[model samples]
Target chain A: MLDAAIVLANFVVIPALSYGSLLALGALGVTLVYAVLRFANFAHGDTMSVATMMAIYCTWWLQSLGIDFIRPLPTALLAIPFAALGTVGLLLVIDRLVYRHYRQAKAPPITLVIVSVGVMLILHGLSRMIIGVDEQRFFDGGRFIVSAGEFKEWSGLKEGLAIKSTQVIAIVSAVTLMAYLFYFLQRTRTGKAMRAFADNEELALLSGIRPQKIVTSCWILVAVLAAVSGTVYGLDKVYKPFTYFQLLLPIFAAAVVGGMGSPVGAILGGYLIAFSEIGLTYAFKRVAGHLLPPSWVPDGLLQLISTDYKFAVSFTILVAVLLLRPTGLFRGQAS
Target chain B: MSGRDRVYFVLCLLLIIGVGIFQSWNVALTMINFALISAILSLGLNIQWGFGGLFNVGIMGFVALGGLAVVVVSAPPVEEAWRAGGWRVLSALFVAVLAIGGSLFVWKRWRPKKYGAVSLVVFLTMAFVLYRFLFDPAVLAIEKVNPALSGFLGGFNLPVLLAWPVGGLLAAAAAMMIGHIALGLRSDYLAIATLAIAEVLVAILKHEEWLTRGVKNVTGLPRPVPYEVDLQQSIWFQEWASQLGIDGIEASSLTVKLCYMVLLIIVLALIFTLCQRALNSPWGRMMRAIRDNERAASVMGKDVKRRHLQIFVLGSAVFGIAGAMMTTLDGQFIPSSYQPLRFTFLIWIMVIVGGSGNNWGAVLGGLLIWFLWIQVEPIGLATIDFLTKPLHPTSPLRVHLIDSAAHMRYVMMGLFLLLVLRFRPQGLIPER
Candidate 1:
């Protein structure tokens, strides 16, 4: 029983944690944009993909220069800071060229959304133009640091557990970043100014907080988060440009399902969405069998649903949340 | 006519003639047809957005439903296929609808303790069993029938023109249902809902092979105009072409395309007239008032929700007619070919560029933007080719750069949109 639990933990729980961490970072980007920009930046997903692709390319270039990491962690980790810087520059340019006019005009929220849609297409086309519409997996490094066989035998258990070393790195990096962000927001003057700006933009402006600086800072932070999250997710899975674009729906769902403007809510919502997607799709046949008596278990009812419908599950939760609490659980202002 | 109007008119004519001279007459005519259809789409959106200020990001869904209406109204019925699995499919649909309706009733009517807890479970269990019972067998039966030509039930054998209005009605009905639930929410939420639902609608169209032939695509849809080949073969056409001092083949093709262009223009004229009348009406005034300020209108006893719903349905109807015409022009109902990126954004660009809240502006925008969309690709390719002329034929950089220019159209479109929004926020023909 304990062995099976360990196996389940290693496979399901650990992966979920990694995914949750990644989604939390992505959600942070989205939530920050919603708070500061006061519109859902649909192009963020594609921007993330572009940043990660840059990092992957740079990592390959660096590795060719014989700058190899001896650890099991992917070399892309070393390339992420450079990727974040590149993304920050890219975002600032987009803001200056495309979004600044709309912001100055004080367009309606929907017009801004339409502008963002245009931005999304431009970014999407740019990414595809540069990278081509192909899945690239350039992050493969050394083998597992702690193989499942080693852990199972170490515990003297019947079922073996596998924990990828990259997964460990992802969780730790995410938590550390999130911690820094919370500290920055709570303890720093600039972060307080950001919060004050988000709380009421007009008031913030009246109080002499420079809107451009705050907006620029928000975009930079969002760019860094998006780049890190995208790199980690691409490393964990595979990076496909279009897949990231499609992921806008679920990521937005996560951010909105929590409250749009609340950073903590975005994190919570990410994990909630991740768990529902994985948990609902997971067949509990083995788990049920372990818990229940032989005769009482139903044959096919153990499988909640096929994983192909995982998107449907996220959408369903979003709809349910919207129907029940339109303002979201955290009561942020509606867009 | 006013000097500005005359000037604008002259500019438009010159642009059209230039397009005709640069491209073939047939290609130009095809662009005009697409433009007219897009005009109808933009007009529909204008009613919702420009008039009522409702954000509907699910135009693609309503368009697909409109196409489905064409299939249902015009395609010849597949008798053998229907006999094989029609009853099963019907039963599945019936059970699904009943489950949903029953659950709604239970939730709304019952005051029992913990009823909410059990109601959802009961509804789901019933739905699953009923779905599996009908779905599995239906799939087998559908496969057993023709398996290739007509593996699913086909449409009613009616005149193809009937599909247009029917398409509008179908789309409007779907819009009404969605709007009824989603209209009360904030605009951003509506955007997300509509976008998700449109994706769902597309998924259904793709997965439900028994209905839409899935990804195989239903083709050879009936056309309102004669085929160019047939025109070429006609003796009357040939004689007229020779009389006009033009090559018979080229004349015939151009004549057939011109016929299609006229038909589209007539449709556009009819829709434009109707839309213009509606926009000038009291209802239109009310919609504008609501759009400009919803709360104010609501306080004035305008029934804001109902008015929004009305515009939503009306706009969806316009989209439906446009969808039908597009499918008719293509002579196919390729569900997979319908993408949000292409269909949705193009129409938006039309509405925004032409001038919202003005029917004439919408049509003009539609025509101009459609022309630009088609022309930009060739222009991009030409520029890339010119730039890469110095490179070797097999050079990777040249190949990569040349291929990448195809995506430059999107960047151009985005730039165009941003420029329009910034410099001329009121559009080419601002609403007077």
Candidate 2:
């Protein structure tokens, strides 16, 4: 039982938690934009990519400047604030130049989505240009929080548990950010104004909530979330522009599943999607072998679906949720 | 056509001719063929969005289905592989379908609330288990046959030209299924749904080796026109080339391309004429009315949902036909090549840029955008090189600038799209 538990925790639980944290952060950004803007920001993924790329660049620059601290953690954590600030500036500029006119014109949501797609393409290209299309690894500190051998020696268990420092950092930072966000939304005047505007634009406007301030504040929060999430995701996995673009689907799924405009729902949806994707695709042969009697051991790898079909799992869940409950599990804004 | 329309048309033609003059004719013709395909795709999208006001973003999936149709219709069947486990595989698929249908039927027909739900779940689980039990063995058996040349079941050997309409039918079938499920969704949700479906379709195409030969690709597809090599070898071809004062190799290849051009032109002309007729007809007017105000139209008994479904299927069929034509032109069907950027969004850009509610505008947009999409990279590279000439050849900045130029087309395309959306949301030729 202990061995099986160890196997499950190592393969499914840890990875899912880290991935869920990353996705929750992304989904929060997406959900926030959807709530405040009344349009799906299709460029959200690329925006994250740009933020992460900025963080990577900042990390490289900091490293070049011989700035080193906190030996076990990546230098990227230190650079995230600068990256978030840069992203905030960039997004505000984009909002002014591209989205502001559409918002003022009261263009239909679909048009805004298309415009966001155009933004996605531009940011996608810009990121590729700035940081060529090659995969970049920026993590420099301690590789593991708990090495498998160390765990084995300490626990005297047949199965060893390995945890990465990045995973711990990702989960901790994401929790901290989410906590701050909830606090802001629940307590702050500006946050309440933003929420009110999202809930009812006309009513909020009549109530003296400035649209421009809310929009600016929304972009600022989204920038911070996107930068932190992108950087953390890159640190956990590997930074690739294409990977971020692909991450869009799972993030969208998480946001939609959690209830598009609900922050709490987005967090829940992120873990749901992350677990389902990882759990469904992972072969259970090893765990089964450990858990089952030799006489009943399966012949095959016991994976429900191939890893190549990981995206399909998320898509299937998304489609199922959309078909069954358009408003999502958390019952966000009704279409 | 109006004077401005004529000018736009001429300008587009001039652009193609410019390519012919500045670049080689072969390159220009290649661009024209692809441009023609893009126009068809744009027309399809225009039908859905302009005529019906439906946002269908799954163009890539329908296009992939069309490519798959070519593979299914033209490729010679692998008898040994089929004999190995094809029957079993077909049975497994039938069972899977029946399982879904059966579970759905039970849910709909059964009145007992608890039992109905429980039975439905049980039936589905059993069906899935049965499907895997049968499917896994059959797939292994079939895949093990040759494993090198033909490990999977191939298509019926038929005239490659037949694949075009067949592809349309396949795409229409897929569109019907997708439309039924997604049409009722809100506009934004529908877009996301369609996008997901397209991604799923491409994912299946990429991974399902038995069906599409996966990423190994199906090359050397039979072509309607004579092979260039074969044409070059013939004495009649040599004499024709000498008369034209062109090299044999160029003449043969050009002749084959011209043949493809003729076929493509016929299809494009047919679709264009039909689309124009449809736009002028009462059906078109009713569709426009429905699009402009769905609530009003629905109150007037327009059957808005049904109409949306009709236009969606029709538009998707057109995409399928174009997909088939593209595969035929390439003489290869590479599943990996069907990307959202190339097959889906690019066409959306064309539709938006050309003119949403205008067929002629769609055609113009298709041609103009495609030409730019192809040319922008080279132009960007040249500009970068020229600007960086003052810098040392080995300068990192110069190298980076030159390298970055390759990506400028995407940025330029995005900027163009935004610029068009901002200044002229109705596009180059606004709807009359």
Candidate 3:
């Protein structure tokens, strides 16, 4: 029982938690934009990629400067604020130069979605140009919070649970960020105005809420989320521009599945997708070997789906949700 | 067409001639061939988005399916692999389908209402287990046959020309399934859904080695035109080349290309005329009306969803035809080449720039954007070289700029799309 528990915890639970947190951050940004801006913001993934690239560069600079204080922790956390600022400034400028005119014209949401696709292409090009389309591994710090060898020695167990430092950081920071976001939304004047604007733009406008200010604040929050999530994910995995672009689908699925305009729903949807994806593709041979008697052990690896079909899992869930509940699990505003 | 439209057409001609003069005639002909394919793709998109106002972004999937059809319909079958496990594979697939159909029947007609969902799930699980029992061994058997070269089941050995319409049928069938599930979505949701579906389609093609040879790629598929090597070997071709004062190799290759262009032109002309006639007909007007005001059209008794599905399938069929032509031209089917940016959004940009809701505009956009897409990198590299002429031969900035020039096409395309949307949302050729 302990062996099976350890194996499941190490392989399935830990990985899913870290991945879910990263997805939650990404989905939050996507949902926020959909709520306030009234378009899908297809460029959200590239936005994260660009911001993470900035953070990566900053981390390199900090490392070159011989910053030893963050030697035990990944340096990307320190660089995230700077990256977020840059992203916020860039998004504001984009809004001013491109999206503002369309917003003023009150173009249909579909047109904005198409326009976002254009922005997505431009951002994709810029990120690739800056990063050179090579996979970069910038992780520097403690490799693991609880090393498997140490855990085995300490627990006197055959199965050992290894937890990575990045996983811990991702989960802790994601929780803190969500807590702060919820607090702000529930307690602050600006957050209330933003929520009001998202709920009913016309009513909010009539009530004297400044649309531009709410829009600006929303972009700022989304930028912060994009930077933090992208950096954490990069630290945990590796930074590849195309991977981030591919991540757009699962993140969008998370947002839509959770309910596009709901923050709480986004968080829930993120974990749901992350767990299902990991759970479905994972071969349960090791866990089964531990749990089942030797006489009853199965010959084949007991994976429900292969790892190559990971994207298919997400897509199938998305299509099923869209078909059965167009408004989403949380009953977001219907189109 | 109006006088302005005539001028636009003349300018397009001049641009092609300019390519011929500046580059070689061979390069120009190659561009024209691909431009013709892009035009067909854009016309399909125009019908869906411009005429029907249905946002479909899975163009890559349909196009890839078209390429797949070429392999399936034209490539010679691996007889040994077939003999190994083909019948078993077919039987497994039949059982799986029957299981699904049986489950559905139970859900719809079973007397025990409360146990329907549970029974359906149970049946599906048993079916899945049964499927794996029958299917896995066959797959292993087939894949193990000469694992280096023909490890999987191959296609019917037939004339490649027939793949074109077959590709259309395959794409149309897939589109029907996709459209049925996704047509009711809002525009943005629809876009994401289609994009996801396209990715899934590509994923299947990439992983299903038995169906597509997966990423190993199926090369040397039979072509609609004579092989350049064969043409070069013929005495009649050599005589023709000598008469034209060109070398045998160049003449043969050019002849093959020209043949492809002629075939492509026939397909393009047929589709163009059909699209134009449809756009001018009452059916076309009704589609446009639905697009312009869905609520109003619905009130007036139009089956908006059904119409959207129709246009969606038709557009996908066009993409499939173009995809088959593309594979035929290259004499290969490479699944990895069907990227979302190159195959899907680039076509969208063409449709938007050419002028949606207008077939001629779509054709023009297809031609123009394709030319630009191909030429922009070279132009960027040249501009960078000219600007950095004063720098040292090994200057880092010069090297970096040159290296980055490959990405300039994407940036330029994005900027051009945004500028056009902002300044002239109606596009270069607005609908009449």
Candidate 4:
């Protein structure tokens, strides 16, 4: 039973928690834009990619300059702030060029969304052109926080549970960032203005909230989120442009599931989606073997669905949430 | 058509002829064939987006379903795999579907009755266990029959042309299922939901080895037109080729492409006429009314949701037909080939730039955009090479720029799209 518990924890819990954090960060960006801008930013994934690509180049440049001062952790950690700045500039320019036009024109939200699709294509092209389309692993940090051998020896358990340093950093950073975001939204003046604008734009404007300033601040925060999440995710796994784009689906799913525009729900929805995705597709033959009698061992892998169906799992949960609770768990202001 | 539209078409023809002059007739013909397919896809999208104001970005999914329909229709059945475990596999599927259907039926019928929910849960658990018990073994047997060659159940060996209509039906069905779930909500929900469904369909295609051979791919689907080798072997073909003063091989391939073009043009004209008629009809006017103002149309008792659903299905069917046509052209069904950027967003650009509400505009956009989509890489590459001439040969930035120049087309295409959206929102050939 203990062995089974260990296996379950090793396979499902830790991975899901880390993955959930990544989704939370990505969803936070999408949610913020949806709330303030009143349009689903289809280009969020590509924005993340552009930021992560910048981070990757920064890391390479730093490594070349012999700036390996952060020995135990990835040097890329230090490069993230620079990437965030670049992202803020990119997004602002995009907004000024593309979105600002539609916003000024008083176009419908869907039309704005369509413009974002065009933006998505441009960013996608830019990222590919700069980074090239291949998987790049830039993590030169300590490989593991808890190696399977170390755990096995330390605990004297048959099952070995390995925990990577990247995963730990990802979860910790995600929590830290999310905490700061929550604090900012709940307590800060600018955050309040932004929230007021999102809630009722005309009323907020009448109440002396500067709409342009609020939109600008929102985009800045969104850029920060996109940069941090994109880099953290890249650090945890490898950076692939297409993979980053695919992340848009699950992020949207999380944002929608948690209730769009609700920060708390984005976090909750992130973990929900991550747990369900990992828990459902994970094959349990070994874990089952540990618990069951030798004679009653299962012949098959005991997986409900295959791993390739990962995207489908996210969609299923999204659809189910839409059907059962259209507004989401936290009662977000859904379209 | 206006003189401006005529000019646009004439320019497109000149461009094709120029490609034929500089490149080859084969390339030009290939361009024309694909442009027709793209136009068909654009027309389908224009129906949903332009005619009915539905924003569906899941064109890739329906197209994939159409491609899948081709494999399911034309590919010969793997008899050995079938004998090994096909019936058993079928039965297992039947049982699983029945269990879910039965549960839903019971849930709906006795929602107010005591113990209804409990009974449903209890019944589902047993049903699932029984299903896995039956399904796991059958799948293992089928996969073991011929893992190298024919591991999965193949299609009904039907005529290739038949696959187009069948593919359309399949895509319509998919659109219906997806629409039933997503429609009647905010318009954006349809966009996201359809996007997710498209991804799901592609995922199913990529992984379900039992269905369309998964990523291994189903190739060499029997062509409706004569094979080039057969044409080369015929005595009369060689004489005809000599008379035409072209090589037998070159002439035969061109003949095949011409045949394909004829067939594609026929289908394109048929769809264009249908869409043109629909656009001008009372039905089309009503769709435009709903699009322009849904609240007013609903107040007028126009059944907005039903009409949206209707157009959504019709458009998806058109996408599916084009998908099958594409598969026929390629002579294979490669599930991995359906990328959202190419199949979904690019087509959206075509429809937008072509004048969404006009059939001729769509065709013109299809031809023009497809030409650019094909030509942009080369153009970008040559331009990059020329610009980078001043840089040293071994410079990393220069080498990287040259090597990655192919991606510039994306940037160029995006800029073009943005430019059109900003400057010419109505597209090159505006609807009358």
- Say which candidate scores most in DockQ: 2
In candidate 4, which residue pairs get closer than 3 Å at backbone N, Cα or C atoms, i.e. clash?
Answer: none
Measured against the true chain A, the candidates' chain A TM-scores are: 0.96, 0.99, 0.99, 0.98
lDDT computed for candidate 1: 0.81
Clashing pairs in 2: none
lDDT of 1 by residue, B1-432 (tens): 246645765676677788789876677777777877888898888888777888887889888888888888888888887888888888888888888888787777763656776877777797878787787688778856776686768899788888988988988888888887778888888888777777777767776778888788887767767887888888998888888998977887777677767877887888888889888899888889898898899999999988888889999888888888778777788888777777777788888888888777787778788877888888888988998899997899989988887777777787788788778877878877
Query: How much lDDT does candidate 3 score?
Result: 0.91
Q: Give me the displacement of residue B348 in model 2, in angstroms.
A: 0.8
lDDT of 2 by residue, B372-409 (tens): 99999999999989998999999999999888988887
Question: What's the count of clashing pairs in each model shown?
Answer: 0, 0, 0, 0
lDDT of 4: 0.91
**DockQ, each predicted model:** 0.53, 0.81, 0.80, 0.77
Model 2, A1-335: lDDT tens digits are 78888999999999999999999999999999999998888899999999999999999999998888767678898999999999999999999999999999998898999999899989999998989889999999999999899999999988999999999999999999999999999999999999899999999999898999999999999999999999999999999998998899899999988889999999999999999999999999889878999889889899989899988888888899999999988988758
Interface RMSD of each: 1.7, 0.8, 0.8, 1.2
Best to worst by TM-score, what's the order? Answer: 2, 3, 4, 1
In model 4, which regions exceed 4 Å deviation? none
Lowest lDDT sum, 10 consecutive residues, model 1 chain A, at A300-309
How high is the CA lDDT of each candidate model? Answer: 0.81, 0.92, 0.91, 0.91
Q: Give the winner by lDDT: 1 or 4.
A: 4
DockQ sort, best first: 2, 3, 4, 1
